[model samples]
Target: MNSRAPLNTAPPGMAEGLPVRFADVSWDSMRHDIEYVLVAPQRTRQPLLVFLHEGLGSVTMWKDFPYALCEAAGCRGLVLSRWGYGQSSPRPGHEKWPVDFMHRQARDFLPAFFEAIGHDTRADPPWLYGHSDGGSIALLHAAACPGRVGGLIVAAPHLFVEPVTLASIQQARDGYVTTDLRSKLARYHADPDSAFWGWNDVWLNPEFKHWNIQALLSAIRCPVLAVQGHDDEYGSMAQIDGIAQEVPQAELLKLDDCGHSPHRDQPARLIEASVAFMRRHRT
Candidate 1:
């Protein structure tokens, strides 16, 4: 991780804007136009922090949290919208994402995405900060890729499907159809159906009920910080506790009075812990 290439240096006076851009990448046997932005690229020598969004999230949905974290941690941040989210390419028709969709993104799509966007996975590995589904993807990436990424911090991640998660997702499915959820999602995704239905259909599928990664966590060889809110609707404390059991170097942060989104419900605390964690493993 010693190489300091200005692969994505921000344009002059563009730090405040965090403008969205696109990159054509070949991943999972297909070409995808990824939506992304670089935060504080002026700090070329600093470590790279990559933000992986949630199931229904996009680059815009992240708002200014990446900027705040990068500023506090003294690192550069790379935020991207995975295929089917934001202004990136939409999911093909109404097909559902495979049960191993996260696997594909972590083991295949992510590396290719980084390469297409000029982030050298070997020369300058990134520290992943993932939330919800993004968090699960982070765990899969860290486990499968081993040393490709520097380290990771996952918030409200699910290593397996839980009853509560499925119920909530079912509720979300109903909301998407009955309420204004689609209208709200339209603000962030180019095709809200691509993000919502793809994620929903897979999670609600019968085959996904037993999708578990507990066995793979041991393969992760990098520092890991697993954060979860006490009241997280998507998962219980067992998620992070399960991670700690497998990865000896893993640390856990359980926040009180918070929900599924720690960055939103507890930004100050999350940022402080994140800054400290990055500093401790700055090597």
Candidate 2:
């Protein structure tokens, strides 16, 4: 375990007045350090809520949402920039991610990350809150290790690849080149190209079209709250609808006039719903 250090006291960010501590998690398979930060670390007795960012999202990209939600729910928060995103180690230039990248994250990286962070899921399983790609990851984790999850809250998660999602990713690729997407992403990621292309290329890969995790949803035994924007551009209602279908007890919330990101598009509503869900499922 790497020594914890106080993060720079930057105003109006995720940590804020809390003790924002960084951990260097050794990802044995990938041989890299995964950067993670804990909010309200002193409140260890409170339920743990792990926040997962989107494909283009990093610790910084999430801004104050994690902190806000954590406060409302009165829980500890764990926000981490996945490998190849944010200040964490970038993807190796020679390596290419497979279609099962999200699966790998859920089954492999998350467990290692939890161990490195000294979180014993078996003794105290944490609730998972994820957005977009992160949402999908949260579901995968819950499915794979239901015993280690207290509950699940996902926003705009993808259970399967959709034509609309492919189109949006393609548009993003064009925007990355034709517009200032790269520059904007640079504010959050150390190597924006690694983050961009790693996500973009895999989604656009023809073989990836068949990627799906619908079958795995049945394994998730914990309580679930799946939310999506009514106007989500990346995916259709079928995403959350599919969750409801598989996880029959899964709660669904469709926000009006919202987009792919419920945390950004309708945070207050999301937070309220999330707090209620966590409280209801609190063991």
Candidate 3:
């Protein structure tokens, strides 16, 4: 793993008045670091909101949503890319993502990341706002470290791999090799294969169908607001519904005529629901 590309080079921007800093958290399996941007709130010492990107997402992929949401809620935000995505360290070309990638992200990567950023997990628990795969990661993390997170807002998360998901991922595999997906992904990832196969190969594997964490939902003790769109192409409401059924204090928000990317498809509703959830879970 290369040690340099994933490291932060500068702040996000000055226009938002929220100070953004680049960060690097070391990992044992690889010598590289996972990179992230920290956005401090304008006037508060509230719990940090950690933004986790989608399967095909990166730090820049989240664009300005973190900043806007953080500003609206008057809280700091930390947006990070997993090892294979964004400006984070590139994985080896032959590296295969473990079936427990989401688990590793939640239990291992996030804790190291928060500590590296100088936030005390015991004193300043972060709120997780995860989308797609990131949402699964947030749920798994919150379940594993219930006391480390203040709240959760998950959008289009997956608890179990559905047949439809496998079929779609198989299609993506074909597209990555035979279509223009590679070139398109290159625009966001420094090494597109690292990002693509890291997510794709794992989801498409034959043995991954039973990789369900729905039972883990009950372990999440924090306030949770699970949101999903009526027309999400990647997942169904079963994702959030699973949370509501198991997590005693979970809230549900369903959006109409929306797609997988609610933050992009239904920005206003997403913001409103998210702001309300954050306020409701204020610690």
Candidate 4:
């Protein structure tokens, strides 16, 4: 985050959350433990919003937006760091994320995390607000869980990896390996490589070029709002365009002068659009 950027509207809530361990899956002979932030609003059973962070993001990286958004929407929230992020355990240095990383995040890991957090997704699937890679995961999950999810808000999601994406990711890798990017990432993640390669290598690898989730978007049955900025460096309008095309009921919001992070770029507009979308989708 730039030092000159405006501070988050609300201060980050306390980060003293307890650790949650998920069973039924193993990574490196270890059952992963997830660190999460749960915020329940006053009185209503207002929808539960689960925030999925970016490829290199952790719970703390979200700053205060989750809290602010939850307050604005009068909803509860669950913000969790996937394994190998934030306070979660680190992935083995030699390991590489599979081509199915996003799918596992959506179909396998997410359900376990929510279950561990006491959220019975079978009864009430969450309203997912995902950024970047997280946005992609949200789309997959909503599609896989069709009738379960209340709604989905995907900010800068990718249905397919474009050349532009690989270029940007390659640049990021160079910055991390040769520049001070590691120190910078230290502010957000416990192990910067866990943050960096976990995203970079997979996105830039040759085999990942064929990775596409357009079919998953077509499977989504609930309301979905796909927002992106005109100036996003990682992807273009085609992302949201594909979503609208694949999911006929999907809504689109394109912003000017904004980049990859819509919530950070235009907080007020993001909030207004979100509130309206939620209301439109609520049962």
* Candidate whose TM-score is highest: 2
lDDT per residue as tens, model 4, 114-142:
66556677687679999999999999999
Write one digit per residue (lDDT tens) for candidate 2, span 200-247.
988999999999999999999999999999999999999999999999
Q: Please give the distance, in angstroms, between residue 198's alpha carbon in candidate 2 and its true position after superposition.
A: 0.6
RMSD to the hidden true structure, all candidates: 4.1, 1.5, 2.9, 5.9
Looking at model 3, residue 179 earns an lDDT score of: 89
Q: Which regions of candidate 2 fall more than 4 Å away from where they truly are?
A: 10-12, 18-21
Off by over 4 Å in 3: 1-22, 41-44
lDDT (C-alpha, whole model) for all candidates: 0.88, 0.88, 0.81, 0.80
Ranking by TM-score: 2, 1, 3, 4
Candidate 3 C-alpha lDDT tens digits along 158-267: 99987767877788889888989999888778888899888998888777887999998898889999989999877878888888889989999999988889998998
Local accuracy of candidate 1 as per-residue lDDT tens digits, 1-283: 1122333443232356666678888877778778888888898888999999999988888877888999999999988889999878899974779988998888888888887877777788789999999998999998888768888999999988888999999999999999999999998888999999999999999999989988999999999999999999889999999999999999999999999999999999999999999999976
> What TM-score does candidate 3 get on C-alpha atoms?
0.91
* Model 1 poorest ten-residue lDDT run: 1-10
**Candidate 2: C-alpha lDDT:** 0.88
Task: Output candidate 3 Cα RMSD.
Answer: 2.9
What ranges in model 4 sit over 4 Å off?
1-29, 41-44
lDDT of 3: 0.81
Ten residues in sequence with the least summed lDDT for candidate 2? 10-19
TM-score of candidate 2 relative to the true fold: 0.96
Candidate 4 C-alpha error for residue 128, in Å: 0.4
